[model samples]
Target: MIEQSLQGRRAFILQNTTLEPPPHTPELALHVASEITPIWKMTEEALEEIGLPPPFWAFAWAGGQALARYTLDNPQIVTGHGVVDFASGSGIVAIAAKKAGAARVLAADIDPFCEAATELNAQANGVEVDFTAENLLDAPPPAWASVILAGDICYEKPLAERVMAWLGQARAAGATVLIGDPGRSYFPRQGLTKLAEYQVPTTRELEDMEVKKTAVWKLP
Candidate 1:
């Protein structure tokens, strides 16, 4: 489990020891680094340092842990490939892709703060990744990446449908789309292949229930 020094909370990591939960800075996890596993707490000082504006919710969802764990164990999938983490909650998936030998990695999210968190965590993890705050669906496809990674995006139907549509377009353009979800209801079952399955642990924030197991999946 990783111990989050910022929040003083500990969580189990996929491949190794638990990581200290990241500081509860909006720019760190809620915005920038979507790949780092969440520890479920944060300090107000850390939040202030990141310039988080008032009237913001403190809690967040991080799906990149499961994706990162899978990538770390399946290096062949990302080795020397160009990768992108779409809807990157904390850039966790992109960071994992880089660790797994991707030639280049990009963490993309709609929230500007998420980009900041991605950068912070990338630096903390001793890696480099391209971070973007734009909504990819509104912008043209990034021609640089050949692989797309998504995690926990199926929780919401409208968003999930939009992302899946984009992934289909990306796939049609020759890019591989891989998604890691915990069996959300909106997850599209057809036109995708289950590359792997993992019993990912989850908390109440996103699940809206007690802790439970989540499944990881990949595309054809």
Candidate 2:
């Protein structure tokens, strides 16, 4: 979910991806991989050998597309507010929030390459999104952020547990917390309030089904 890209990674992105709108949220365009790109054929070890991590930034995941749709449709949730987009792969959610009139948006990811990828996507969308390669989970949520958005963060048990605990802290501090998940195993359901759900279109490569039942949830 994070990286600080040297020139090579950014170059790879520029060479490999095209400006295309995600299937579910077609209102915004991003720098994303196409089926024909070399990125798809590269293995994890191959990517690592080139000093790159898995190119999560190259695809728009289901959770992010769901949250982007919800936020755009209901701008009141983020309009005129300072927002933070956590683990912002491809900057899809961040760009959507900005388009929906968020006063300011900060996109944070630990991957160095995500910084470059998000920046490129933001520019392509004609929106301004401040991004940090910093792993925001390493510290407290910023005091000025009134809205916090996390997408697909529950894919891993340890990450889901840590993110939920941290988001809980943010909620306690009065920030509105929202998560987009496709019923990932590590994502708990009992305590959260569901706001919206969608059958998000996804690729077989990225999800179990061609369309996933995903939901947007608010931390109680």
For each candidate, the alpha-carbon lDDT, in order, equals: 0.62, 0.87
Candidate 2 residue-pair clash tally: 7
Scored by lDDT, the top model is 2
The residue-by-residue lDDT of candidate 2 on 1-220, one tens digit each, is 1122356667778777888889989988988886523674552333555545457788899899999999999999999999999999889999999999999999999876688888888888899999988888889999999999999999889989999999999999999999999999999888999999999999877777899999999998
Off by over 4 Å in 1: 1-62, 208-211
Candidate 1 contains a number of clashing pairs equal to 32
> TM-score of every model?
0.71, 0.91
Expressed as tens digits, the lDDT of each residue in 20-81 for candidate 1 is 44232112232221222332223224233343332111223434566677777888888998
Q: What is the C-alpha RMSD of each candidate to the true structure, in Å?
A: 8.5, 3.1
Q: Number of the top candidate by TM-score?
A: 2
TM-score, model 2 to reference? 0.91
